[model samples]
Target chain A: MTPACVIDRAKLRVNAERLKTLCSQRGIQLRPHVKTLKSVQAAQLYAPPGSAITVSTLAEARYFAAAGYRDILYAVGVTPNKLPAINNLLGAGVALTVIVDSEAGAEHLIAFAQQFSSPLRVAIEIDVDDHRAGIRAQDPELIAVARKIDLQPGLQFYGVMAHAGASYGCFDISSRSAMAVQEARQTAEAARLLGEQGIPCELVSVGSTPTALVDIERPGITELRAGVYATFDCVMAGLGVCNYNDIAMSVLTSVIGHQVDKGWVLIDAGWMALSRDQGTGSHALDCGYGLVCDAKGRLLEGWYVAQTNQEHGIIAHRDGISPPSELFKYGTTLRILPVHACATGAQFEQYHVTDDNDCVSTVWPRVNGW
Target chain B: MTPACVIDRAKLRVNAERLKTLCSQRGIQLRPHVKTLKSVQAAQLYAPPGSAITVSTLAEARYFAAAGYRDILYAVGVTPNKLPAINNLLGAGVALTVIVDSEAGAEHLIAFAQQFSSPLRVAIEIDVDDHRAGIRAQDPELIAVARKIDLQPGLQFYGVMAHAGASYGCFDISSRSAMAVQEARQTAEAARLLGEQGIPCELVSVGSTPTALVDIERPGITELRAGVYATFDCVMAGLGVCNYNDIAMSVLTSVIGHQVDKGWVLIDAGWMALSRDQGTGSHALDCGYGLVCDAKGRLLEGWYVAQTNQEHGIIAHRDGISPPSELFKYGTTLRILPVHACATGAQFEQYHVTDDNDCVSTVWPRVNGW
Candidate 1:
């Protein structure tokens, strides 16, 4: 069927190995974020059973935990309401570490842990670049939050972690490398501050796809965590972190109709198949919704999905050239390289894993929703 | 748990009845498009079993058909690859009607139907506005496409249908009413053209949420179809098609953390919970991702989701005012009215149907994938 999520197994392995080699050379533990693919089968290739993994939702925590992943990190800032689910995961003998950036968050965790029997591992999120959530590394509040967790009988101060999400804005290698150093240094600084307070920080984690790929010395960081690296997207390609050929995931769509005069080719894949994350929209060469490709995953120059309705995608040439009749024949299947792999991958329940010959080798089911 | 899709059953019924009354007064059949909620249980309120309904995918067709919905319309342009699935649905005794906007599409359906024992009903999509996929109503190609289907022994020329998608661009009642008339008139013209060729037109369908709501005469239009009207969203509110209070769908999220210096209050609902559809970005009031509301669904004056990561949303006041500590206490659950109900609803596998008192009454599972 058309409008299906396709994963090139060969490219996926190459992408996964690239990150693994980078982390191995840097002498840092790689905690692959399973949030991108959210598939147990996909993780089998990179993050095998028992490998430390990062997840964005408790559902993923429970899923990966059930799949024998003992060490799991719930990367998102924890809320009081999700404590019950976390408690259940811990009760199941999973070493699930949760992150908090505020004293208020620590207070909630402390309160929830009062009723919990086992000690909950808590990590303080350090803000290296003021990118989304997290407390500033230099903020005295970082030590205060760590102390709050250490003081609680049912809580264990795990460490400090930071994500240089701003590195995504960096187009060149030098800037991204600098951001990577800043990410590692500040997160390590937070851990050092906690260490000075007699709270032994076991882990210091920092990463972003661009930052993690940079060959830079990260002195204090013990672990590197990054999602979307395993399935490089148009965003990563636009940022120069990876080439477009490295992108493993794409939406396979069939050309249904076209507006010949307007030079628009309509496909079945809309935001429903290809997500509305126009991550490369700010780049000099914006891949509208996604970059268009041939059925065999070869890019069609200048053609991108310009607009999308719920179930219809409009493919337009960047130069306003009409779609060639031979190339875009009715019912001809085409592939679309996603702007953000995580967002596009989340839109489907399963991925049709294709081998080197572009034949469906297997189907990988994804764990979606919280 | 927070970051869940919540639907107000009371408001949903009210919105459904409003359209039902309008269609009844105009003496037209109301074929509600189930693409918004995609839940059979949700459709039970607006469109019960035996009612004519429209679906975006074959999966939805099979889902609703399994739930006893016999009269289904696969509204998107039919492709050759989907013929097998459509055949299966027909084999299951579903009176499924497929649509085509081009002669190529009609040719594909005709050729695919050759291998089948039963006839396939096909509708000619008339373009009322140059918004999306459809053949122009006045174009001679429309008649040519209809004639091709009529001539095919295995295909039945169903009728003409048009969706005034550009009606969403109209922010006033008068303009929307005019678009509605144009939508109905143009679609009726296509059916009349088919009739002039000695081919009797059975159905004349036309609609869009904005156009469907207008109290106007649709002379030859036999049926009115709409999806988002059952759950008005920020886009509909921005267009003046419906009030914010009329909206039934929202994402319930808990305060996760905040960046106080930047006037950002982080919530658990990001683009993952409330989709990345910025349908109202061009409106006077741009609801970034969605408009914020109180836990009980009361619209907050100026707070809106300003930015989003995969699992984190940054809510900010429109006036750049810092988040008030009292209102945004840690773990305080809030609601977010979606920009596009259909997109937001598609994010979740099930919707939490709430009562007037804001208590969850039931859970309705949705049909998500294609």
Candidate 2:
């Protein structure tokens, strides 16, 4: 499989197991976000039987639901147009959970739900870090949104959800821990605030790959939702969240030619394969496009895919030395550990799973697009 | 369609017709590379009946073949692993052309061809403008590789192909023209050299949207392969190759939320939809990830998607002033013209084609991955 995405099954299993163990120890339910891989095989490993799964797109929710993921959470803020699809999934016996941060969004859901005979499971998103979406946890509108959902005839107020995507920017352990604690507190406080208003907020969720992997305590957080941890990447490595060996996904490419004078080794895996995600740009060490590794998943010292075109990646030495032509002969296969697993994995249609012996064992199809 | 890829069918027709007329005037065949759109509908418009098409991956070649594209060229350097797929296409009576830049690549093709009863049409990739792949036009190995293919049975030396990818970096018309001239001359010279060696070189292909659009003369170039011209992008607009109006492709997204204080209006279209290709980064004007446009394809002045997450694009004014919250309210549909047409188009599985009235006329499915 040339120019393919290779997933180290062992590393993926280890990552998933570690997360499961951590969540179990903290007595928090693990609702693994299936949006990262969007593979039923990987989803099964991360989200076992009776476990809920988080999805960013309705397409993913539909795909996973077809694959027997009953409890589906469309994590992204719900829009008016997506109501029909969410309603269809719910009609098909899927316990679909939708999120709303604004009253307008809640109103849209309420209006849409009135057309349906059954209740639509809804969650109020708390803006714990002000990263992307969600209403500020301290905002009075949070209680209003929850009350709106609770009072609605055909909408069930599930609880609250928070993702401190801001924690990804924390490069230090202490900062990540602090962000994790803050995430937990803010989300729990929102739930507490809702409970004070006579609303039964059973679920209080908050998570991010970095925060979920580091935080030692979660006082009131009942559930965690993380995705990238299952397939660690250069950004996670740069943040000291996981070692390079923990990264399961890689782009398998072949050396086509070289620019010996420019010290560039041209590989078939370009931005189209490795993805144009410069996730490690803000870190102490920027790994260009991705870290170059041999076919056997062993890292090639001092080498990186420094530049890329649509279909050509230029591998260069980090120390500014020319790579030997004989060492990187034409047609030799190489693997590239991507900068961001989610972005990189989304580029490919499927993953070529490899075993401990570095032999491709199976091919897993991935769901892409919205 | 919310957070979808929208292709302006009228603009695409204009772009395709312009390229077809230009190639006709220049006395060259226009074999538009389908790697950009990867849609049979778009290919039908670009290549038309009896016209050849170029592809970067065998998956594309197979897809086009299935869609009744008889003549196809796998433009990327062929490796041994791809032989079976090429042979499968060839066996299905598709006139597939494979490219090779190295002697090792040629030998692999030769070895693969030996197993087949019929000959494989091969093209020597010439390195014009010192771009990504292909052998240097002046290199002696160019002749050696061509001779090797010509000498081998079950392998036919088709001609030469050159892509002036470096011309993308040429921001000025004069520099672009110079690069175009050099691209045509180098590729033509390589074909001439092969012809002088008593080998018939039927084709001399030179390409890249910039070169094909700007070049005034092509002495010996027989065919031109350009893809992105069918769907102009921000990078092409920044290079002055095409106007913003000529950009047929735009990601149709809706405002999901906002950070009013930070002057950020969040859209549903993120890197997953717009792509992470920062093609305009080196230009005088970097249009962040993409240029912001209203739902009707009208440009929103001084506003662009400055930053993006997996499924969220943060739109902001180029200046520091915050956008009025009323103008970009949640659920307001917005269109984003991407930086690189190829990279952005590859992110989607289909294109929602619209007419001048901004009414979606038809949905065209796109093929992805190798």
* Best model number under DockQ: 1
Model 1: DockQ vs. true structure = 0.86
Candidate 2, which segments miss by more than 4 Å at Cα? none
- Residue B54 C-alpha lDDT in model 2: 89
TM-score of each: 0.99, 0.97
> What DockQ does candidate 2 score?
0.65
Per-residue alpha-carbon lDDT of candidate 1 for residues A87-175, written as tens digits (9 for 90 to 100): 89989999989999899999999888887758889998989998899999778898888888998898988998999999989999889
Put down candidate 2 lDDT per residue, A79-198, tens digits, no spaces. Answer: 677777777887888988888888878888877887764688898888888788888878989988899889989899999999999998998999999999999999999988888899
Write down the worst ten-residue block by lDDT for model 1 chain A.
A110-119
Worst ten in a row by lDDT for model 2 chain B: B110-119
Which of the CAPRI classes, incorrect, acceptable, medium or high, describes model 1? high
Error of 1 at A141 (Å): 1.0
- Model 2 CAPRI quality: medium
